[model samples]
Target: MVSNQNSKNLYQALWSSADILRSKMDANEYKNYLLGIVFYKYLSDRMLVFAVDLLEESASDLEEAQVIFTKAMDDGEVKDDLLYALKDEFSYLIEPSLTFTALVHDVYRGKFQLEDLAQGFRNIEQSNELFENLFEDVDLYSKKLGATPQKQNQTIANVMKELADLDLAHQGDILGDAYEYLISQFASESGKKAGEFYTPQPISELMTRIAIDGKEDQKGFSVYDPTMGSGSLLLNVRRFSNEKGFINYFGQELNTSTFNLARMNMILHGVDSANQHLRNGDTLDGDWPTEEPTNFDAVLMNPPYSAKWSGEKGFLDDPRFSMYGVLAPKSKADFAFLLHGYYHLKESGVMAIILPHGVLFRGNSEGKIREILLRNGAIDTVIGLPANIFFSTSIPTTVIILKKNRPNQDVLFIDASNGFTKGKNQNVLEPNHIEAIIDTYQKRVSIEKYAHLATFDEIKENDFNLNIPRYVDTFEEEEPIHLGELAQEIAATNDSLAQAEKELATLFGELVSTSPEIEKELAQFRQLLHGGGLE
Candidate 1:
């Protein structure tokens, strides 16, 4: 149970240490250095608790909390089972004597222990089977943290000491909250580069809703993201999801480094590796074990924009691409990613993917893919999101929801592009924007200008072009230029001009409505001519 006060303390402490490194490194680089340290701390704390539990359970000479509140321990068999469970639990094996705080306190006491700190991080990552290679090249003592070994180690040690002061309660409180706080802080500062990795919270919330709404009871089916970044998108689904069906989380990412971060994020968010199987490789090229693909209920993604791929000639034969009768263009692989997500979706599963607006209107092979998707009614909904919501990209993106089963042949088009606000450096959707989008999806409501339910005949007439303008009619005709009003206004202006000419002894120039100087002078002349010169 983390109180708001405790959360604040954790935020301030972690941010202070991270802030020290801001001037020393780029926003992206600082993330590795800082997240590496925080993760190191979490592992250290877990290990320390495990060590103490072992000491107490076995009556060994180590500090341990008295089992004050548990009557179930009265059974020796129960005690044995608990011990075995703790031993098997990688998340619970830490000892208090070896806590991160203990080590950092030593550093604050004049001990420059960089080697020890580095080894501690390595040991914890190695100790956990799934988290191996988790902090690759995140060497806190590297030249990236500082120039020389002495300076690097010294700064690294100081950073550890500062973080030790933070009150991040484990399992559910401080550490986990602080990790999210840091990820957001770093993401915002990193700009468009961050967008490539992190999906904004509002967007993720909406995606999760689109995936999990109405599926809360049935279990065994899973949800996946083919291009999992920080794992925030997957983990958050579990948090905000309102599911009537059970969904085990799954995903794959080409970036091994981000894959590791995704795994760590899932664990911190209370998802065991047993529940979420994250693969590290290009999902498009790799055949995710048949078991992984066949179990999903939903999939959500915000893949890299227009990523270049081996889109070789033979790729037309790949199962994910071959079915469409054409390959996605070599240069822009938006639909390629979409097809991959679509293939992984369960027969009745739903998947929502973020893509550039070009995917809607781009012709050639891309148009063919769109035709196949719509012809089969795989497209459930098309949502246009506000701009700057993504990190490395400020361009507005659209979310394409593909369902294996659509009861109706009508495609839902939502023009929510103008629904967000401009944040300090980026565009952001508030809760209202997220809710409106989610409600529209749930109710399938038709908003006059915001959403349209377009039939297949209409879409076919547009030649399979899913461009929003064709469906939503967002264009506003220039409020009919009033020629009659213009003539009458012109006559009034001419009369005023005559009066002004008599009063100011000068000819009046006709007002050019579009001109800046004429517009300003018109007011002055109108007043002077209509009611004589100014007092």
Candidate 2:
């Protein structure tokens, strides 16, 4: 564990590296360089520490560890043995010359070359399937870094120097948190593009809590996020689960760059390669994890809202959507994403998804699909979140909780739209607010104006529209108006106005103009104030 001040220092240190590249490119483009380098440094630092631990030797720091490793590598037998050990432990090898500490030393000596860093990245990617092409998005030769070779080298060197002093090796969770801090800062700067790769942390926490409410203690628990942007939402499960070490993470992303980000995020958080099941592909195009343990204990998603999809007729026969008898509209694949995740949910599992409110009330195919889910008692709860809670968009969104088998068709509606702290850039759900939601959800009881438990007949009464307002009556009747008191107040206001007008008329009467034309105008004004329109 890291102290709060140390965590703050680490976050600032990592974020400051971005300043070197901010002027040259937008956040979306520069984040690859910043994050890739940071991840490489983490791997290098860990490798040096692991080598020291394996040898049972005393090394004061990474610098000393690098020296020992370099001297050991001078002997052919020692070099081969060390390489095998590193490969077996980390599934990768970082040569003494290519380590982050060595690269920084070269930078200070004016001997650093872009190719060395590029080669280091290549070695890691080629080490194992888990790391294959992990650094593909970090393009060292891109003109975006600089126009000439020397300038690009200087640019990369500057960033490396900025990060060289940070203690990424021993700071366990702090290092991963700092990396997340950088990602969030970049997401804030990326604007609408942030939606493709990030979900607000509070929303992630809320969903994770709800999905893993009852089964927090279950061992070998699994969670899946089809649109696992940066894998932050998937990682939140570990935060709230008791079986953190045994939890399995399964996810897929359509964006290759974002997929790489998720992979790095997992490793930075110290997630084991064996426990991580991530794929870089379109989740909706085809089903993945098509093997044993296909379904998960929990499914959490915050997919792109209203994204266009093929919505081909062929999907109707697909097991995921076949039972619905209709496919989600092409213009809005919200339901398509929902059904896909729901299909992979275990019978006893709980799934939570964030989507636009339209899915609750929109008619036609979506309505029919929603009806089927509701009829089957799969739709468990609907939580309305405050607007402006996301960096990507200001529109308010809802979290719909689903379950597989239920005895009743009751749906809990929580109107938490107004329960967030207003922020300068976006609204935020404070801890208390999140707890209130989870408490209400677990209790399954209604609160006045805040929550409501509606029966199946009520939903059918409203034509099966699952809108929050229909279920939770947040409307507060205007405090009954006191007509008699209002009339008295109005009469008092009239009397005060009359008294002020009389005083004004008296003031005008005292104004006597010397010129005849001005006196005539004043007299007419006094006449109007006394009995004409003014009265």
Q: Report how far residue 142 has shifted in candidate 2, in Å.
A: 2.3
Model 2, position 392: C-alpha lDDT score: 92
CA displacement after TM-score superposition, residue 255 of candidate 2 (Å)? 0.1
Worst 10 residues of 1 by lDDT: 60-69
Where is model 1 more than 4 Å wrong at Cα? Answer: 1-3, 50-86, 91-98, 167-174, 242-247, 292-295, 477-535
- Model 1 per-residue lDDT tens digits across residues 203-295: 887887788777755565487888888877776666644441234778888877678777777767666567878788887666674662454
Root-mean-square deviation of Cα positions for candidate 1 versus the true structure, in angstroms: 8.1
Deviating ranges (above 4 Å) for candidate 2: 1-3, 480-535
Clashes of each: 24, 0
Task: Let me know the TM-score candidate 2 reaches against the reference structure.
Answer: 0.91
lDDT of 2 by residue, 1-535 (tens): 3569779777777767888899999999999999999999999998998888877777888889898888887878777888889889999999889999999999999999999999999999998999899999999988989999999999999999998987588879988877777788899999999999999888999999888888889989999999999999999998888988999999999999999999999999989988999998888889887898899999999999999999999998899899999999999999999999999999989999999999999999999999999999999999999999999999989999999889999899999999999998999999999999999999999999999999999998989999999888888777989999999999999999888877877788899979999999998888887775444
Note the Cα lDDT for every prediction shown: 0.74, 0.91
